[model samples]
Target: MNAFKSKTEFAQTSVFKLPHSFLNFDNFVSVMTRAHLDRAYWNTLLIIVAAVIGNVALGTMVAYVLGRFEFRLKKLIMGTYIALSFVPMITTQVATFTVVKNLHLYNTLWAAIVLNLGTSVLQLFIYLQFLRNIPRELDEAAMMEGASLFRIYRTIIFPLLTPATATIIIIKTINIYNDMFTPYLYMPAQKLTVVSTSLMNFSSERSTEWEMMSAAILMIMVPIIVLYLFFQKYVFAGIVNGAVK
Candidate 1:
């Protein structure tokens, strides 16, 4: 019951060393300095933007088609998508490399982006579900005004899909940012490494650099954590809006 007592009694562990440790600061300066974390930061950033925007845009378009338009074998298609959702990415890991190799995407950052965009099955479903709740009257009115399908999507539905869009972007931002396996598997070049992949390398190289690794981990995670902390309200709204309706 004594919150202050709990706070006062808390002790810093000896194992948890400070980031700017005097013991190791001078050693990593040489190797770390040459590598230049800034370059990696920019690279990671470029990959994230490419991955997130591509997935969201494509996913949204697919959702709109599935939601608004009805044709033959629609249920079968939806059912297949749902079934594919259950298949783990690991099941197709072998083929991904072959496909990437055929396109000569290996060791390149673009491979990271392309791989993620194609696998956004869950996102498409979320978009489709949200679009379903939109009134048919909206489309009818837009049609009466001579709005082409692309125009209606560009002008009408897209604006209204903002909540869903924002939600997917935030969530996918975290996913793509922290994703280590894909980049490691698809693009093994240390030069093409992202925050997650770099952290993995740092962790292994500096198995003893717990403090630096911790600092690096925090450095990579902080921005995303802060973003969610501040925008959790809207994030949840978007998720629920799409999930429920």
Candidate 2:
């Protein structure tokens, strides 16, 4: 009966064998087909798009003001933004819930977009610094040629700023794509999820399914990586934009 008792103890141990859950290609396809890709992946793409557009537009404008023109309170305003950059992100997490609720944006795709769209102080500062590197002589020449401010910006300033803008867009896209917490708090409802939050759900329902998780994570990561790879040159130029001249 010793052998029988040995088997009984083995079965009773924490390491006791249980039915293995196998993940094969068929299971993967089934999961992929069933997974809510639209709610998460597409929503993330939309948010990233909105954030980049808004940031690029507003950031360029702010950079123009700070870099090209001068006025009262300019230093104060720019300094305030720079100071705000130091405030830890954790401090805002608890407060944004109420603001988001008042705005009635929670659990919506707009919630993600709106939350992400505001000017990033760092991006603004980077763009502003880059703008400073652009020679004022270019603007003077444009004005001498009777070029309008808008035309000058469109033809000269904007083109010259391409390196910074592309780099900023790429950086912002990766940032928004990877940002999970803001969406988690502001878009708590599963119906309007993004990749970051969806990844969590994918993890929960398929905790034992690493292959699927790996695939899902890879899917979320690959596009951003590819974008950065494609624009690697601009990324370098952006980094060096203000270093010379």
Best by TM-score: 1
RMSD of 1: 6.0
Using alpha carbons, what is the TM-score of model 2? 0.79
TM-score of each: 0.83, 0.79
Candidate 2 lDDT tens digits, 56-125: 8777877787788879989898888878889998888668778888888877877777777666676776
- Residue pairs with backbone overlap in model 2: none
lDDT of 1 at 101: 90
CA RMSD of all predictions = 6.0, 7.5
Clashes of each: 0, 0
